[model samples]
Target: MSDATKLLAEKRTEFGKGAARKIRRAGNIPAVMYGHGTAPVHISLPGHDTFQALKHTNALLTIVIDGDEQLALAKDVQRDPIKPVIEHVDLVVVRKGEKVTVDVSVHLEGEAAPETLVTLDHNTLQLEALATNIPDNVVVSVEGLQAGTQILAGAVQLPEGSTLVTDPEALVVNVTQAISEEALEAELAEAEAEAGIEHEVAGEEAGEAAAGEAAAEGEPAEGASESSES
Candidate 1:
């Protein structure tokens, strides 16, 4: 566990959307801190500092509010849909030595056997570790894995002091033989046949347009003959 990042926060005296907007205008983000049977604390944090601190998954923060410090973890964060600005945040207070359950990223390293495709069934793993010692991610090696091989959750090696909270039998990674080009083309053709009504309609419409153009072209010659006779 790395040391918790320190952040300075100010207690929010006003509530409502207007106050929050004011805080944002002042280059701060509104946030709420709760957990451990304590009353929820509403505060404002520095926008740049808060954004940088949250870049790490399961980031532990030491927030200084009113000269008092509390350790916390970022539980939820709200952001602008179009902008990269943090709108709001929810923090959960945590204590040293306490075990917290969180989902850690699973990273794949190395390649499987040639002509095999490696599929990650689970991208994250639920784990229980000390609040201050959570790992950023777990790396799983697929080197030389053969087709039909599966790596289960229990088979993954976790960082020391971390325990798996997800089901042990859950499939994490699967290695399978890659489909040949011929097989892929065949499957695509089959799918097209299954949904061929639209294509057929389009083809028929094109054919009718061609036939109509031919008929229109032939009608001019017929009209010329009828006019000469008249």
Candidate 2:
């Protein structure tokens, strides 16, 4: 996986929100690289290049800082939820043989048995793998599986040299018979009623507390007035 992604880098000369906005206006995204017991280094990367690279999850980066090259992984990326703009990215430096923990999405490859609904209980699995050799996604087959069947985390085969960091007994895929509409509605109503009852009880307790405080102050003033009259 030695596909080197080239990015035009620029040094961030200023700090704070104003500086970040200025960087974005110049078609660049502010990024900070930190890891391996080093102070965070702030920099700017070409907006288009950063966006394109991040489109691939677990993107490997060859960052050039002041003519020095470093291998990094995109640890975090902030983006506009509805737009194509990049905000800020957090990168972690990595060595060739270093192992890192990451989460990979679970992908179902085959269909379940007839009339059995395949439910994905876990969408992703945690894995500890070499930095440069991370798997894109974990694929699991449910071909011809019947109802009441389950696939555990450990049962899903991982790529060679990759170790599972998630709990072995964690349920990944579950095949269950579909519930009827009546049962679903009944459960929903019961949950809502339980929540409403709890809220009402809390409100009553708060009201009682306020009333008690008011009564205490009123009694103190009444006692003072009676003593003055006497």
Which has the greatest lDDT? 1
Question: Stretches of candidate 2 above 4 Å error?
Answer: 179-230
User: What's the C-alpha lDDT at position 151 in model 1?
Assistant: 97
Give the TM-scores of the predictions, in the order they appear: 0.83, 0.76
Tell me the lDDT of model 2 at 88.
96
Instruction: Indicate the worst ten consecutive residues by lDDT in candidate 2.
Output: 219-228
Q: In candidate 2, how many Å is residue 220 off?
A: 80
- Tens-place lDDT digits, model 1, residues 21-59: 999999999999999999999999999999999989999
Predicted candidate 2 versus true structure: per-residue lDDT over 75-107, tens digit per residue: 988998998898999999999889999898999
Off by over 4 Å in 1: 190-230
Residue 174 C-alpha lDDT in model 2: 95
